[model samples]
Target chain A: MPQHPPPRPGDERTPGRAYSARFHLLDRQIVTEDGTPLAKADDLELIPDSDGSLVVSAVLIGPTALAPRLRGRPARLLNALARRLTTGPTDHHARIAMGHIIRIGAALTATTPPVDATLHPLEDWIRDNVIAPLPGSGHAPG
Target chain B: MRLADLMGARVIDVTGRDIGHVSDVRLTEAAAPSRRLPGLHVAGIVIATRRRSRLLAYDHRPVDAPWPLTALARRATRHALWAPWTAVTAHRRPPRTGEPGTVTLDQTAASLTPLRDMHAHWNSGT
Candidate 1:
């Protein structure tokens, strides 16, 4: 549980500092303050800061970041998936600015707004074809 | 966010890098004849679901449990690495990659040492 008190409007210490929550930290869900689905750190994008010291700027996501790093069957599957879900400019990933990142420990805690992203055509397709027919798709049921 | 989810889902073995569609869930401890609170203890899960979705109906009623495929390759007593509700990490296929996968982890799913079991094609070697 990444339970943290909200920043008091203008706190400066939480953002822009780099910290690793631990190795288990990778692939953790980065949720917004309102608890929305954000992209995963498919890989970390590390670049030296303005001070010339190596720093992790933003966590790279989307197929472009993950697919090249992966190969063979997984690669084919990823490419097909990316092709199926692309609804727009087809960048495939919504990048979260490091500045919007409120915390970097536990589950990635951030405060970015929804991209209004309709990226997962497969997920939406499943919701329509497979999940929707499963009795409770129209309702939250809980 | 529940172990009850592995029933009919496709699972990506992050360690071995092979995608095994979930077939069956094997629990370590069965419903303790008397106590059904915790219900069942998780054991090794069987990936029975091949590419076809019809195969999912072959078993008894599939339980919607969290998919614990991540723990299978880690360096630990397979007995200790079961996921609770909060441990169930739901993932959608990335919009960019369009891969559909979710990870069932307790507090420690992502940190497990990648098991060196695969030869070459089997392990993506990430």
Candidate 2:
């Protein structure tokens, strides 16, 4: 058997490198260019290539993408609840297209906006209804 | 399809013998058209005979870490196998209620490369 040298930490960021999806991609935090946290990469969208090999298409975020990974009764309930909360006819997880990704390091950086309505509908609702009603909520604290 | 759907799918050989379950997916940056970030192509699937928690990458990577822990991980994944993506003849079936999906391989389990030997192949950059 041939022996190979150990890979240095952070080597996965190197272009054209081979990486294990579980270790390098899944569960990694994703952020926008200005350093605002978006969401963790809960699941990956894989599309078949012309040769029938799978290529990563996008990073899938939110509960709809995560529930299947949890895999059980709780997962089923969570999936059902997420479906009900979703507003559109096509109920699907929020995805950040691979084309938008700028870099993959400790966190994946993308050109996507900080806040997306589809990404966090519940959070948006709470801010608009509950938080907006509070006195002095309009201004950011210094 | 989602990568989550294939994560825990059972691997079956051409003769219908159980091999193992997919432990992790291996990807390589390969050139492809119509992509901004370099395309991550599916390279292979890591299959382990026993249903253990994450391999922690000790099976393939050279991690001489905090002594005993590294030794334990190496022992745990001794029987793991590496099946190239080309060997996979079928994608996973839609998961059933409380059951995992299945991935069928055209080759037999014995013909697959051992996980321990994968590092060399990966380093060769083939």
Candidate 3:
């Protein structure tokens, strides 16, 4: 076995409160400041720091972000389907920047609105192309 | 890069010994430059020698409800190691298709701290 320097006291601990990504972050709901549900945090976007340490850059949303985590054959199928549905590039996934996040409790709260065009393209397409053409689709439910 | 890419990557020590696979990533809230909101920094990763589903974090937390289940979870993760981000020397993407990526560490596997031992320090208001 290769000999290595011993870890200093408290070196194993983080400077701030520790959170396990799988337990605390993944699959959590993300909502806007006014409590409007935006999306589930399907995945995380990591960016390398100056020291090459990875940092969570953004919360990734939608099927494109989620498919990879599924792994194997199902993941490939979902990825292919999502690619065909999207008009953007193959890697396109809706993101909410960390700067916009205000809290990360039971649900992530963001200052940014949930109405971005890229946020839910499929839903928007359905609302316009399919729902709008239906009779009485314009009226709110009583 | 995405966290998904690193989730199941193989972890190897300086001697090229297969220690374990990346089980869960640990994050900490840190002061961000030019931003009011704190950024979530990658603190380290938890590596498990055996293939297992989600850890449920019983190994690192004081959760003891349903004693039997908690005991099992704690036993299952006893050998898990916590490799600090600083110890990570390189992250090599697989050169060929169908191979898992590798996370190389500067230290030996024996030198790393046990994941369970970290609970006290992390919960001590640090």
> All predictions: root-mean-square deviation over Cα?
17.8, 6.3, 9.4
lDDT of 3 by residue, B1-126 (tens): 778777778899999998988888888877655223347788898888776645666544544568988678778778888899999998875443234568999999999998778766775753
- Per-candidate TM-scores read 0.37, 0.85, 0.84
The candidate that achieves the highest DockQ relative to the unseen native structure? 2
Put down candidate 1 lDDT per residue, A1-142, tens digits, no spaces: 2244443433232322222212323466666675565667655443322322223345555665455345347866876677666554555454555556665444566676655344344455666778879876688652
Off by over 4 Å in 3: A1-15, A140-142, B33-38, B64-66, B93-100
**Residue-pair clashes, model 2:** 0
Interface RMSD of 3: 4.2
Which pairs in model 3 have colliding backbones?
A: none
Model 2: how far is B69 from its true place, Å? 4.0
What DockQ values do the models have?
0.03, 0.49, 0.38
Residue A134 lDDT (model 3): 95
Choose 1 or 2, whichever is better by TM-score.
2
Docking class of 1: incorrect
The candidates, ranked best first by lDDT, are 2, 3, 1
Reference-based lDDT, residue A98, model 1? 52
